[model samples]
Target: MKLLIYCLNYAPELTGIGKYAAEQAEWLAMHGHDVRVITSHPYYPAWRVADDHCGWRYQREQRAGVTVFRAPLWVPHTPSSIKRLLHLASFALCSLPLLAAQWRWRPEVIFLVEPPLACSPAALAFARLRHCKAWLHIQDYEVEAAFALGLLKHPWLELAASALERHALMHFDRISTISSSMLSLARRKAVPDERLVYLPNWADLAIAPSASSVALRSALGIPAHAVAALYSGNMGNKQGLEILAEAARLLAGETGIHFIFCGAGPGRALLEQRCQDLPQVHFLALQPAEQFPALLGAADIHLLPQRADAADLVLPSKLAGMLASGRPVIATAEAGTELASLVSQFGIVTPPGDAQAMVRALQALAERPARRGLFGAAGKAWAASHLDRHAVLARLESELRRLTEGGGAGTRGTTLEGLGEK
Candidate 1:
């Protein structure tokens, strides 16, 4: 099977959507599928490219087995609506012309990633134009995500965006999400049950932790003595790092447990400032995604905290990475979160944002290090059986194959009849 993935973020960008897209592309290529990724120049999480790729507009690169084509973009990385809209518009406009040209030359089943729903229009149109089918990968319910972050305000705009998303999902060949909750939400909004698929985040074996290093520990100033509770990923608003800070406030001056957060985001500076006044907490800025295996290998325990509102639309993408790193997760978020399920699926959950509970769990895990093995073992077992990248790409391949083969992929309406299940 030959497939093309169109997304706003891709390799070199450390955002959730970027990582997942790259992983799937790599796996499909490895499995002998002809894979191509059409994405904009790298800039995400922090919204700025690294010092090297600064002036480069567009280029083609090879990642594993995938053929990657880059396009120029002018959107700022920050969250302001004007800049975001510009960014979205730039990708959609730039991507469409190239993708349209690419289609004429080399057509394949296209997969569209949401937010920059503008991107979806072109990919969807191109698929239709080519007399082909496309699968829409819905990660977060973007409009709801914005509302969860307190960015969405106008009710009419919400309705319009909701309608647009529904139209896209209903018309697309298949719509796969990262969680059951999101699948339910997608159905409620109007996706046909058969066309809908649930493709949760999976651990990248290539990125899992290797042997622990004393040099690595010393380099980060992590003492050979202290018990470390690490949160390594985005420190964005959706993560509810403030709640983790509240947990830190409760554990302040405690000698046994320590917190190490390593990642970058719009919220990192605020997080650093929040922890500065509160001692016993350390903040490290973002590291390269390539370094994840070694960087995350050192955690004694992992923290996954989501803003209660965030759990609805945004699944903590970091959970997959954490689980893959072979460490036990200590997650606190809204009830019923798929991530929180990792804690239970592995049997180690505390209520969302409860400082006392976090402190106690921290102490217990600190005192008994062997439980980390059990947690990690469960995650590895589950991931290997269910959520590995290769498995997900296979499921994706099958779904897209069905679409290309004119198999069953029905659409649903607002009434949601026969939706959310198939």
Candidate 2:
């Protein structure tokens, strides 16, 4: 099968959607499928393009058997609502020629990743023009999230954007998202039940603690007995990371508890400023892929904080890694949401943005080594059963094959029965 993945982020971005997008493309390529990616240069979680990819021109490269085409875009140093839209628009406009150039390739499936739903129209139109299937995999519901998070406040604009979103969504041959709640949202947007697919994010269960894990802990100067509470991945507005700074401040006198904030984004500078006076807090830039597993293993507890409004709209991709790391997680999520339910199974869930609750949860786990061990074991077990990368990708490949073989469009919605509970 020949597949073209259109998305705004891709490889070398290290965390979030890019990591998964690149992984999927490479997996498909390795599995005897022809995979190509149309994406912008590495600018995610950091909001700045990598130095090597800063040139304002189109470039192509081969990565792990996959053909990757990088299109240049404007990345805002300090991204605001308007700036973010402009940023996404830049990619959509710049990548058009690249998309058009693929006319001769005539991919069997055009798998579009959302967040820059800005590119949806072009992707859909191109798929129609080539008589190929158009598959949309939504990692984030940017239209709804923007309004819900107050990133865009005009009611009229919200209505207009939502209408446009629905129009684009209704035209797709297949639509997949990372969570059941998101799938439900797609259905609410008038996407037929038969078109919705639940494609959950997956984890690499093969990752394990190594010598580098100990080295990382030592290098960070975490006391031998101290509990490391880590919040790793993008430091973005939707993360509600300010609560973490507050939680760290409240726990400042607890010498045996340390906080580590890793990864970069528009919110990192503010988070650093807020934590500057907290001696127990430390920060690190996003680690290399080779060191990521070690970084996960170094944490005694993983912290996942989400803004209440952003909850359910976007599930953090980092959760899979945290669970796979065999570490206890303390996540801020509302009751009844998928994130809360999942974390409650193997870790702890506090109401979103509740610093006091987060602090309490951290303190409770800090003193209970046995309980921590139980949670870690349970989380690892769950990840192995439900989030193994091979299983998830194999299912995706099967779906792609089915779609290319002309069996997907009218099929019933793929149930999550074996993957996990709805």
Summing lDDT over every window of 10 consecutive residues in candidate 1, give the lowest-scoring window: 411-420
Clash pairs of candidate 2? none
Please write out the lDDT profile of model 1 over residues 148-212, one tens digit for every residue. 67776768867887777767876887887777778778878766687777777777665454554
Candidate 2 global CA lDDT score: 0.88
**CA lDDT scores, all candidates in order:** 0.73, 0.88
Writing each residue's lDDT as its tens digit, candidate 2 over 115-137 gives 88889999999999999999999
- The CA lDDT at 413 in model 2 is 48
Which candidate has the highest lDDT of all?
Answer: 2
Worst 10 residues of 2 by lDDT: 408-417
